[model samples]
Target: MTTKISSVGLLSPGDMGHSVGKVLVHNGMPVHTCLAGRSERSAQLASAAGLTVNASFEELVQQVDLFLSIVPPARATGVAQQIADAVKTTGTTLIYLDCNAISPETTREVGRIVEASGVTFIDGGIIGAPPKVDGAVPRIYVSGPDADQATILNNHGLDVRPIGDVIGHASGVKMCYAALTKGLTALGTELMVAAEAMGLTGSLREEFELSQSAMLEHLEKSVPGMPPKAYRWVGEMEEIAKTFDDVGLTPKMLLGAADMYTLVGQTPLANETPETRTRGKTLQDVVEILNEALPKGK
Candidate 1:
C-alpha cells in the first residue's frame, strides 16, 4: 500500500534535519516538527520552513504518521521505546524510520519495541550530509521486515536501498565501515599532530605532497561527516566491544582508536583537526627514523 505522506512529522531536527525537513515541505509534504532535546534555534529554523513545531516528543509522535528518529545513538533506543509505548495505546500502525548511527543489536531492540506495539519499523541509516533542499539526494541504507517502506522512501527523491534480512544487517554495515574509515582517520591525525609538535610538520607535509596523499585527501573530504558521526561512534565502540567478546581477540587497540576519534570529533576543528594532527605525528615519527638512519643527525 502506498502510504501517501501528505504530512511529515520530523523529530529532533538539527542542521541536517532543518534542511531535509524544508526539502520535504518543498516536495509537497507538509512537515510538522517537535523538539525534544533541541534548542531555540532549531525551533526557529523549523518555523521558518513552514513547519509546525510542537512542544514535546510525545506530541510529535502522536500527530505524525511516520516518525523519523534522527537523534544520537545513545538516545535512539530510549526515544524509540517512549514513542512505541505511546503508540501502543493509539493502536496506529506508526511507521518509525530509525536514521541514527547505532549497532545492529540496538536496531533490533528498537524494532522489538515498535513492532511489539504493532508499529511498522524501517531500519535505516543516513550516509552523507544533507543534500540541496531542492533535488537533494543523500544515500540511505534501509532494511526491515517491510519492503514497502523502503519503496516509499525511494520514490520521494531519497536514495534508499535495502540492506537485506533484518534491521541488524543495515546497522552492522554502518558500524563496521565507520570503525575502519574513522580509525585510520584518527591514526593519520595522531601522526600529523605529533610531527608538528616536533617541528617536522613541514617535511611530512612535503612527503605527503610527493608520496601517498590519498589518505590526506580522503581526510580533507571526510572531516565534516564527523560532527554528526562522532556521538554515534561512541555507541558503536561499545558494540565493537560486544563483537570482540564474541570472538577470541581483545578490542583494546580498537577501543583506544575509538576514544581518539571521539576526542577530536567533539572539537571545533574536527573537520580539520584530524588532518592537522596527522601531519605532525608523521613528521615526528619520520624525523626520528631519518635522524637515526643518518648516523646521529650527521
Candidate 2:
C-alpha cells in the first residue's frame, strides 16, 4: 500500500522549518503550522512561505495527513510528547517525522512515544541547509519500520532517502556528521579565542595561513555566523556527546564543545538572527567577544 501524503502540518516554523514548509507549499501540497506562541519573525516566515496557520494543535492534528517536527534538540522530545497526546486524544493517525539534530537514543524515545498512540513514527535527519527553489534541496534521510512512508516527499522539492529499516539509522548519520562539523566549529572558536587572549591573533593567523590555510579559511567563514545559532547547538552538542558515549567511545571532546557553545550562547551577539545579523562580522570579532567573556586561566 502506498502511504499517501498530500497535507503536511509543520510545527513552529523557524528559519529551517519555514523553508521546508515553503517547498511543500510550492509543490502543491497544503502545509500548515501553529502560530500560537511563535515570534513575530516566525509568523512572517510562515506567511511568506504560504503556510496556513492553525488556531491550535487540535485543529492541526485533525487536518494534516502527516506531521513534520523540525525543532531544536532540547525541545524535540517535548514536542513529540505534545503531538502524541494530541493525536491520541483526537484519534488521528498521522505519520510523524522527526527531523531534528538528536541522538539515536532520543529518536527512538520519540518513536515509542508517538507509535504507542497508534501514530506511525519515522526517524528523519536533515543534512545541509534549507532547500532553495532553484538551488539544492537538503537530503532528508529517514529510517524505521515504516520509513518508506516518508518517500512520499520525493519529487516534492526534497531529497528524501531511506537509509535502512531501523528507527535510528538516519539520526545516527546526523549525530556522526554533526559531531565532526559542528565539533570543528567549537574547536576553531576555542583556538582563536585562546590566541586572542595571548595577544597572538595576528601571529597565529599568519602561521595558519601558511600551514593550515584550508582550516583557517573554513573557520573564518563559519565562525562569524555561529553565535546566534550557538544556543541551539548547545543541545545538539550534548546529544552528540550522548551518541558517542552510548557506543563506548570517548565523549569528552563534544562535552567540551557543548560548554564552548554555552559560553557563545550567553553573549549579546547571540540575539542576532540570520536576517538581523551584524553587517561585515568577522572571525576576529567573535574571538574578541569570547576572550573578553571567558578569559584564559579562568
Candidate 3:
C-alpha cells in the first residue's frame, strides 16, 4: 500500500532542516513546523524556507502526513518521545522519520518509542550537506519495513535511498561514515593545535605541503569550518563511540574525539553560528584561537 503524503512536518528548522523544508516546498509539498519555543534564528530559517508555522503542536501533528525529526543527536530520543506523546494525545497518525546522527542502539530505542504509539517509524540517516539551490543534494538513506514509502521524496528535491528492511541499517551507515569524516577532523584539530602550542606549525605546514598536500588541504578547510559546529559534533562523536563499542571495537578513539570537540566547544569561537562566524578564515587563525584557550602548563 502506498502512503499518500500530501503534507510534511519538520521538527525544528535548523541549518539542515530549513534547507530540507525549502526543497520540499519548492517541489510543491506543503511543509509545516511548530516553532513554539524555538530560537529566533529557527523561526527566521523556517520563514525563509517557506514552511507554514503551526500555531500549536497538536495542530502540527494533526495536519501532516509525515514527520521528519532532524535534531541534535542528544535530542533525537527526546524528540521522538515528544512526537509519540503528541500522536497519542491527538489520535493522529503520521509516518515518523528519524534523521539525527545516532547509533543503531539509539535508533532502535527511537523506533520502539514511536512504534509503541502506533506510528510508522522509519530510520533515516542523511549524508552530505543540506539541499542547496545550485549545490550538491544530500542523500537520505532510510531503512525498516516501510522504507520504500520514503521514495516518494526522491524527485521532490530529496534523494531518498531505501537501503534495507531493518531498523538500524541506515543509522549504522551514518555511524561508520561520520566515524571517518568527523573523526578525522577531530584528529586533525588536535595535532594542529598541539603543533601550534609547540611552535612547530611552520615546519609541520612545510612538511605537509611537500608530502601530504591533499591532507593539508583537507585540514585547512575542515579545521576552520569546525568550531561553530563542534558543540553539535560532541554528541555525534559520543554516538560514534557507542557505535564502535557495540561492534566490539575500541571506542576510545571516538571518545577522545568527543573530548576534543568538548574542548573546542569551550572556546569563544564555538558560540558563533555559521552565518556569523567570520573570525577564523584560515587554519592558523583557528588553531591560534584554540591554542590560546588551552589550559596553561603548571
Using all chains and alpha carbons, the TM-scores for the candidates as numbered come to 0.78, 0.97, 0.98
lDDT of each: 0.65, 0.89, 0.92
Comparison by lDDT, 1 against 2, better one: 2
Task: Score candidate 2 by lDDT.
Answer: 0.89
* Better structure of 2 and 3 per TM-score: 3
- Candidate 3 clashes: the total is 0
lDDT of 3 by residue, 156-269 (tens): 788999999999999999999999999999999999999999999999999999999999999998888888788889999999999999999999999999999999888888
- 10 residues in a row with least lDDT, candidate 1: 272-281
Model 2: per-residue lDDT, tens digit, 127-237? 998887757889999998888888877757788999888889999999999988999999999999988988999999999999999999999998997887889899999
Candidate closest to the true structure, highest TM-score: 3
Pairwise lDDT winner, candidates 2 and 3: 3
> How do the candidates rank by TM-score, highest first?
3, 2, 1
Per-residue accuracy of model 1 over 98-118 as CA lDDT, tens digit each: 877777777888888888888
> Candidate 3: global Cα-lDDT?
0.92
